[model samples]
Target: MKLFNFHTHNKSENYGIINIYPEENILFGKKYSCGLHPWHYSENYETALSQIELLAKEEKIIAVGETGFDPKSPVNIDMQSKIFVKHIEISEKYNLPLIIHCVKHYNELVKIKSQLKPENIWILHGFNGKIDIAKKLVEQGLYFSLSENILKDIKKADSLLEIIPTDTIFFETDDKDYNIETIYKFVAEKYSMTLSDLVKYIEINLKIMGI
Candidate 1:
C-alpha cells in the first residue's frame, strides 16, 4: 500500500502535499500546498498574496497553507492573522483543503473558524498540542495531521489519539528526516490495527475532505 503523507516539506516526495512558499519556484508535476508563512511575512505581503493566488490556479496545487499564527514570530499576531485570512480566501475560492501551522494560538484559530465558517476542510499540520485543545478544534470541525513527535511520547499519543476520531486524523513527515511509515507503524500498534487498516482509515478521511 502506498503511504499517504498529508503534509511534507521535501520537494522530492512522490505522494504528498509538498509545501511551497510564495517566494519559491514551483516544481511542476507534484501535489503542493502554497502559502506565505508567518515567518516570512513582510511589508510587500500584497505582492506575495498575488503570487499565491496565481499559483492556486494550477491543477497540481492541492491545498492552501502551512500558514497561520505564530506568537513567537517577528511579525505581530494581527498581521499574521491578516495573512492567514487571505490564504483562507484562496482555499475557499479554489475549493481545496487548507493545511495550517499553528503555535500557541488554538483559541484564536478556533475563534476565526467560528467567525468565518469556511466550507472547505482545515487541517492542523504537525500537531503536538494538548488533548483538550485538540478536542476543542475537533468540535470546531478542524482535522489534524500528526508528525514524528507522537513517537517520542507514546503515552501522550495514546491519549491524544483516543480523543481525535480516526476520520479526522492524518499522518505526515513534515520537515523531519524520517520515514512516514514509522508514524503509520506506531499508530497501527497503538490502536491494535493492521497497517493496511490504518491506511484505509486515513484514505477515507482524505476522501471526506475532498482531497
Candidate 2:
C-alpha cells in the first residue's frame, strides 16, 4: 500500500526546495508541505511572505504552511500572531489546507480563526495531545495528522480510528530519519488497513477539505 505524505521539509523535485532555491524541484522521490517554520520567524516577514506566496503557487506545493503561533519561546507574541495570520490568509486565499505547527497557543489560534473565518481546511501536524483537547479540535472541524508516537495507545488509537470521521484524519512523518512509507505501514497496521487504502482515504479527505 502506498502512502500520501501530507507534510515534509525534505528537498523535493515536485515542490521546489523551500528557502534553498526557486524554480527548481530538484529533490526527487518525495511530496512536500514546503513553507516557513514559525520558529524561523523573521523581522522581514512581509518580504519572506511574498516569496512564500509565490512558492505556494507552485504545482507541487500541496500545503500552505508549518506555520502557527508558538507561545513559549522568546519571540514577541504579537509579532508571531501577525506572521501566522498571514499564512492563514494565504491558505484561505489559495484554497489549500494549512499544515499547522502549533505550540502553547491554541486559544490564540482560535481567536485568529474566528476573526478570519477561513474556508480553507486547517490541519494540526504531529498531534499527540490529550483526548479532551483532541475532541475540542475535532469539534472545531480541524484535522489531526498523527505520527508514530500516537500509536502507543492501541485502544485509544482504535477508538479514534473507529469514531473519527475518515475525512478529518491524516498521517505524516515529518521525521527526517525514518522513511514515510515505513511510518505509513506502521499506522496502517494499527488501524488494520492497507497502506494504499490509507493513502486513498487521505486523498479523499483532502478533497473533502477543499485541498
Best by TM-score: 1
Model 2 scores worst on lDDT over the 10 consecutive residues at: 13-22
Residue 23 of model 1: what lDDT?
78
TM-score of 2: 0.79
- In model 1, what lDDT does residue 172 have? 93
The Cα error of candidate 1 at residue 138, in Å, is 1.1
How accurate locally, in lDDT, is each candidate?
Answer: 0.87, 0.68
TM-score of each: 0.95, 0.79
Winning candidate number (lDDT):
1
lDDT for model 2: 0.68
Cα RMSD for predicted model 2: 3.6
lDDT of 1: 0.87
